[model samples]
Target: MRDVNPKEWLALGEDLAPKLKDFDIINPHNFPSYIWAYYVKLRLGERSSAIIWYCHEPLRILYREITDPKGFRFYSKYNNPELKTIDMKAVSQIDHIVCNSRFTANNVEKIFNRAASVCHPGINMVETQDCDRKNFRMVTRIYREKNVERIINAMVLIRETRPDIYENCSFEIVGEGADEGRLKTLVKDIGISNIKFCGFIPDKELPAFYAGAKAIVYIPLDEPFGLVPLEAMFHKTPVIASNQGGIPEKVINGVTGILIDPVVIEVLTDAMQRIYDNPQLANELGTAGRTRVLERFTVDSFINKLEKKFFSLSGVK
Candidate 1:
């Protein structure tokens, strides 16, 4: 808004607006925000000082259940309602809505009914995780629904019985959780070092962590939309995600990476073996994923799309 022509400033009313951004929303296939200048226009600010949703997934479902109001790390305090109440309608009423993925867009629309224009999300892709996918690494909040145990069991099975590829590969479980203790027990109960428990790394340094891993893995049995996979893809890393929920929409199976039935360790183990044995296949998939992100998932593109939406609704293009 700082550069908004005086003539345009004369056009908008003073009101708080919503502008969603994400830590890892960028992929050439999905550039959200679309640039950002357009955001200033929507927010009606001296400069765009809108509320940008930090796009929380595992927590979004959990936080809604918190009866007490809480603070948004990026913004400030926000009402704490039942997680189910956070649907699109709740957020849309606030003026604007931005999402990390179209998969998320689909769910947001459920709550708002007529709200939340998705801009995917943006990530600083100047650097990508240097890890190559000769194997697999699982990343997610490890909540109950996230199905962390499944990944561990799958790895154990593969390592014990399927050495063709599993012998050389392992899994990395990133992020901590209530399930952390139990997960450790399961690892010990099964006795597998192939899966490592590297809890949350600081956000800025996460890229380096990812840089060292091969592919990002997520298994949210029924997910709203997971961004970890996309972030992994941002690093030119392939993904092996659950086939449930809206995931198929984000990472195209066989194209971006393999999409398997995370409900069963056998299936997950099978997918891992495939990625391990087929380096050419993994590389091919990861390359396609990178190309997809560059073409559609940039921050600049998101802003543009949103600008068009706002201009159309406000009739102020």
Candidate 2:
């Protein structure tokens, strides 16, 4: 697939609008593609059968500016009023809206004043294997909104307060982003050695990482339908995630995994300790997590639901 720069959205839309009419459905993700779809729908006139928007989140930067200014301040400059107006106008023209989670669907309704259907994205379930699940793992972009520092701080507390638990436990932070250097510096300055930054691991290697982990620590601020937890759960690994956003939909506190406030450092530290102390509890949670994935989050289920939505919108049997 060719990469279309955001700057060329209008030109691309104008060029492709005529050709797009032959297609039954125009499904667009993200703002630029949504703009392109909007133009195509306008140009298609009565020929356009359906324009379904699979929104991950509704202009997150705009919403984050209101909900979390400190975490989203870097993106504040890009939150142009004109751009938001254009995006809203485009969204209003869409025939159907689908979101990845109910959390995101609520955000879409609040932001766009439009009802959206929730179709949770699914993952390929990995076969469970017996492995020495020793280390706590986190697989996420090292960004401010991801709340990586909170986990790092939890590590610091664990080291200082509970030396025995800290001695045995290790953390592996996978994936990289702009906040990586700052987080590494913080780790080094504090002289904590148990945490290792694994950088980006290939998708194929992720199952091994998940399978060998004690728990997947995910505490992103208002994440929109986290796939990391689902991937981890598929490997029969429990997730220790934040209560905020779409994570709660996936990680059930005490049943599938533990959920705590994203801001509180001690809450995260205690949850990790609990998992370490109770192997049976951890195993039970892991088993339940895998069962949850098998029941609700299979790729086949996702595709079937999406197909149903498409058929419903297109007026086809």
Candidate 3:
């Protein structure tokens, strides 16, 4: 709000601040905005107040390693940059907080003296006309954190080791990123021509791909809650993904799709081989995954959780 013309919002805030008295300020990935949020809550909390920060690993890992180590360290005051570094005053301002996963919740407790509830991200599912289903495909965002290179390498190995399955299979790389050029080179270097770089297709267009595919393989380093897999499940497409992050919450291993550490070539290739070897097995897993999503991970459930959390934090009914 400060970066974008605060004067415009000044009147609005002035008018609304007294009339609407609920809404705990949350600065997830607590940037400089947290400072302002803290101040606002301090003034507003004659009744109740909160200011929670959700730290992203990118601020600690990729950004520190790849871009700015010095800047990264300096932002540590709020970034969960290190253990026992969160300011005491900031903690006093907050009531409750949202966490990505139980694993991450433990890390948050170790870093910030805050109890964080796991709130997975949600997506709106769209029902679409069925896809051809014969084309077994894999879809993923090409990025460093996602370990896209491993997917490329595994696909190549799949072709070399099992030529029949390779000839029939199609791997689609969706959502472009830093690894686009490198991934393309890897595909050519490995002599795997069945891959397609379908850059930035809308979510609506995804139904055709999901319906037609055997399963979607989302290989990533660590994800909070990889929504893509659940989205694929909504399409009744099974998922084969890495056993990292909050993936287990969505992907029910053998029931949904094979989960492996995508970083290891042997592990990933072996998992793919299992799927390629058994079409009936893949279909069964896909059906189970879809049912799991309908029950556990849907927009309605996410909204209900958010409302309850908001009420608790704001102390407004």
Greater TM-score among 1 and 2 belongs to 2
Top candidate by TM-score? 2
Please report how far candidate 1 places residue 205 from its true position, in Å: 3.3
lDDT of 3 by residue, 238-279 (tens): 688878767877788899878887668988777767777787
Task: Judge candidate 3 at residue 9 and give its lDDT.
Answer: 33
Per-residue lDDT tens digits for candidate 2, residues 164-276, read 87888799999999999999999999898999999999877888899999999998887888898888888888899989888898889999999999889999999998999
RMSD of each: 9.9, 2.6, 5.4
Ranking by lDDT: 2, 3, 1
The better-scoring model by lDDT among 2 and 3 is 2
Higher-lDDT candidate among 1 and 2?
2
**Alpha-carbon shift of residue 156 in model 2 (angstroms):** 1.3
TM-score of 2: 0.93
Model 2 pairs in collision: none
Most accurate candidate by lDDT:
2
TM-score of each: 0.67, 0.93, 0.79
Global CA lDDT computed for model 3: 0.65
lDDT of 2: 0.85
Clashes of each: 39, 0, 1
lDDT of 1: 0.59
